[model samples]
Target: MADLTTTLCGIRMANPLVLASGVLGTTRAILTRAARAGAGAVTMKSISLEPRDGHPNPTILTFEAGVINAVGYSNPGVEEALAEFADLGDVPSPVIASVVGRNAEEFARVAERMARLPVAAIELPLSCPHTPGYGTLAGQSTPEATREITRAVRAVTAKPIFVKVSPNAQALGEIAAAAEQAGASAITAVNSMGPGMVINIEARRPVLAFKMGGVTGAALRPVALRCVYDIYRTVRIPVIGTGGVATGRHAIEMLMAGATAVGVGSAVAGGGVEVFARIAAEMAEWMDRNGVARVEELIGAAHR
Candidate 1:
């Protein structure tokens, strides 16, 4: 069997397949199932300082190739998350706690609370572009503010921290370098794009209750790949590649382009949990068939 194992920021994942934060990863049961199903690791649903019920009405919808969502970062509060995390047993694999906060204090506080848990990593959900203050901080169009928030979160936890960025920003290289300097162990580029909106022609009204939603799927692959490729060269930290990964071949492409690992979110919504297992198993088989003895060998192997 091919060695599908890969290490990111010092954490060794069973495989590169990861369950990205959102509806599928919100609970321990779901996370445990993902782990069992063969995800190398799982990122918890985005948790915030205070509980948010999120925008009402239709928040999720099927777009042509992937999905458009404006879930509005709804989640149980950190206190409650900590409570739920305490009950997990037989955790199938490493866990990444996804946390979001309004400002530095919330980030620090959430990081500290999660530090007490058994999580292998912490993913700062700084992406939801449609939200007000909280969403933009991670991909803060400005490097200074991004650096400030990263610095604050860094001080509190020694666990590996991955800063998930929004694609809306114009300067990816600058901001990625800033995040690395501010103490992020790794960078996950690029989060969903657009505050793209859809309308119900019949109602002559907007579809989502939030009106605007982030765009994700195959359409985002090029943008995400470019961000990872650029950031990989600009910074010494690892890059968790994402955006439109729906097949084993897509996973290999991201790996070759310098992603130490890749995140699978939107595809799971369409492909189902079996998709996780399929990707891992298929990747392993592809590695062997392609004469790749190890997946790590593919990292940064892109010729141009």
Candidate 2:
């Protein structure tokens, strides 16, 4: 059998696939189901410093490439998430907590709260695009702010910190470098592009309550691959790729682009957690055929 296991930030997962933080990871039942379905790990639905009901109705729309979301980083504050986090009961290999906040202090607060939770890592979402002026704290757009927030969180928590980035920023390289300087253990790039909006012709109105939001789906794979490849070259720390990954080939592409692991978010939204089982089979089969003995060996192996 091929060695699919790859160590990330000192944590060993059964495979390289991780369930991205979002709807599928919010509830106890959903996370439990994903864990059982062979997802190497699962991230929470993004906890914040304070609870937010999120934007009003019509926050998501379906398109050919992916779904546009204006969910607005809604979550039940760190306290409630802590309760849900503790109930996970060790079913998954290591539960990864996804946390987000507006400023550096807020990020630090969320990190400290999650530090008490039963999680192996904290994926800081400092780059949520739909949230207007906020959310881009770690996205490589604002190097100074990214370093400040990352350094603050690193000072408080020992858990692995994975800083996520936004696609809209052209200064992603500087942002990643700053995070490394501030102490981020890994990086996940290209959160969602556009913060796009679709209008209802008859209504002459926006589809989402927030008017615009992040887009994620099959359409975003190429952009995501580029972000991963770029960051992989720019930094020594592992790059955790995410975006429009839906198949075994896409997952393999991310690995070849220098991603230590890939997070399947939109695909999970489209096909359910069973996608993990399917993709795992396909990847393993492809690996066996090529005599690829280990998954980590595939990193940055693009057609050279």
On TM-score, the leading prediction is 1
lDDT of candidate 2 at residue 261, scale 0 to 100: 90
Q: Model 2 over residues 210-234: C-alpha lDDT tens digits?
A: 9988888887789899988888888
TM-score of 2: 0.95
Instruction: Show the lowest summed lDDT stretch of 10 residues, model 2.
Output: 132-141
Note the Cα lDDT for every prediction shown.
Answer: 0.83, 0.83
Evaluate model 1: give its lDDT.
0.83
lDDT string, candidate 1, 164-277, tens digits: 887777877888888889999998887888878889899999999888888888878888888888888999898899888988989998988889898898887778888888
**Deviating ranges (above 4 Å) for candidate 2:** 137-140
